[model samples]
Target: MEPDFPLRKIIHVDMDAFYASVEQLDNPDLRGKPIAVGGSSQRGVVSAASYEARKFGVRSAMSSVIAKRNCPELIFVKANFERYKEISKAIRQIFYDYTDLVEPLSLDEAYLDVTINKKGNPSATLVAQEIRQRIFDELQLTASAGISINKFIAKVASDYNKPNGQKTVNPEEVIQFLEDLEIRKFYGVGKVTAEKMYKLGIFTGRDLKTKSLEFLDQKFGKSGNHYYHVVRGIHTSEVKPHRIPKSVGAERTFSENLSSEIFMLERLEHIAQELERRLKKSKIAGKTITLKIKYSDFSLQTRSKTLPYFISDKDLILETAKNLLYQNSLENSVRLLGISLANLNTERKETINGEKEVSVQLKFDF
Candidate 1:
């Protein structure tokens, strides 16, 4: 066995088809049937899909039209974020009972470092099983968990026996487990990165392990170092209790594409109002305002301007967005409009003279 690997007992718990499962739990009629949680309108997108819907290739972020076409009888349910948040809070409470080092990735997933949990239980595997069972018993929702020495492996292992199961990658097996895994299945390797890896003849963790750090750095930059470390079971990120937001934004897709700026004024105003409300809810303000434009032909464009002072008012956001809108000629008819704020107040770091220095977190460093 490799001697340097940390012996922490980390578990990644992910709720199975969370939003869809919540809908099914509340409305029994939707159980065991193909359902999507989102609108079925022309411009709507699927936020979640049940297991039955997944069988037909219906997935989150898919267009409503394509989802329905994929599953002819797919039922569309409007999303209830408030209910999801309530359940998420309850789930966090459950985690707190076991460990204080709990890190939530989203409403449906979290990482628990149970190496020294409150339960006084030594076996991480058993703790995972008990947690899964408790969730089912209390919330009537099934969750899957992955247990390993670190966050990356645990996150990937969680999906091994999904929907209602857990997988544990023991310390002795960690190296072999990662080496034998498919490159595409690595947690951070998305479709684009996987394709790039395939082009470079990196098909699996073993293949990735063969490359020199210098070679990887040249090809993939800093991410190459992360891959070089993780494939050898070397991810060192701690499970953080407070996950900060990188940006806040709101967007709306129109039922009918608008050709003229005059026709989009009202839509932009409403979007600004929504964005302002979100900023206030989070108690956040930002200096950078970005306007995202999605054309009818599916092309995307963004315009951003940074301010000297933080602002979260609807009027300011709307005015800045309008300026960005008229800053350039429309490339094509607009199908979607969005407003975002970044360089957030939350990102301020303590500096000398009682001032704050804004910093950006390196997201690619695993």
Candidate 2:
């Protein structure tokens, strides 16, 4: 194993059930109670679940029906993204106070490069504590922080403790910490990858370290290289403050699954129009249009086509989406339909109301 990497300080900050926490903070009645933020309708999906709800096996991305079955008393509250966006901006400002090298992963989490911070603190541990403390004092919110030499380890460390806590792994302790970690706990190693590793008897970081780079590359392509380096504490990814979004999309789940061809076409038209608005609002034109369909039985399929030129017009989006839909036969009733625009042309800028919008800082959900 190579241990020649430079020692850089990185911190990952993650909010504690951010959406649910905000709901609880605004309403005194919800404190210490099991609550969820999102719809409870049959077609609704849970966006965030409080720690109490988590104990009942209620999780984000789960169908509302399933969440209710898991926790009969779970209180479902609607999500307020506008409010969440305000808090996220506040939290990001706090990160910027310490370092400009902050990379936000989502509305509730970010990674900050703090090797030499604005406060001149040499200890990343102290910086992390101060950030968490400031968040609580200023926002009345609890956050967990992970401190390590890179983004991967720092992110993992942040999850080591719950609601309000911090964990720091020193350079000397990095290897040992990763070695004892489970393969499933590794970033980017989802269920499918974990199952593959399990079949190869690689259950832990130690087991993963037993394989050579060439062997891993042959088995898992580029991802095998990522796993190989991270297991040995060699993640060199920097904390980028300005990361461009690769795609923009919007989708809706229906209260009633649609089976009729005409009904599906109507839904696609709505989805395409919404997608066009999103692309225009973001000042991005995409060459690739993708249509996603989720069947009532939970099966999912997607069809995409690359256009000759970038387009963000409603008519073009609708026409392309209609063509894609007609080209493929519907296998079953669809529960949800979505349209996305990818292969974005970031170099282009648009002038709306005399102001030039150059880049899109993504903060939309549909």
Number of the top TM-score candidate: 2
Tens-place lDDT digits, model 2, residues 1-366: 223444578999999999999999999899899898886745578999999999999999888889999998899998999999999999999999999999999999999988888999888899999999999999999999999888999988898987799898887677789889999998888999999999999999999989987889899996777777788777767787876778889888888889997998888888888888888787889999998988988788999999999999988988888888888899999888889988889743422121111121222110
Reference-based lDDT, each prediction: 0.88, 0.86
Q: Estimated TM-score per prediction?
A: 0.89, 0.90
Ten-residue region with minimum lDDT total, candidate 2? 357-366
Residue-by-residue lDDT tens digits, candidate 1, 17-107: 9999999999999999999998684567799999999999999988888999999999999899999999999888889989999999899
Candidate 1 whole-model C-alpha lDDT, 0 to 1:
0.88
The C-alpha RMSD of each candidate to the native structure, in angstroms, is 6.4, 8.6
For model 2, the local distance difference test gives: 0.86
Query: Relative to the unseen true structure, what is the C-alpha lDDT of residue 94 in candidate 1, on a scale of 0 to 100?
Result: 88
Residue 84, model 1: Cα distance from true site in angstroms: 1.2
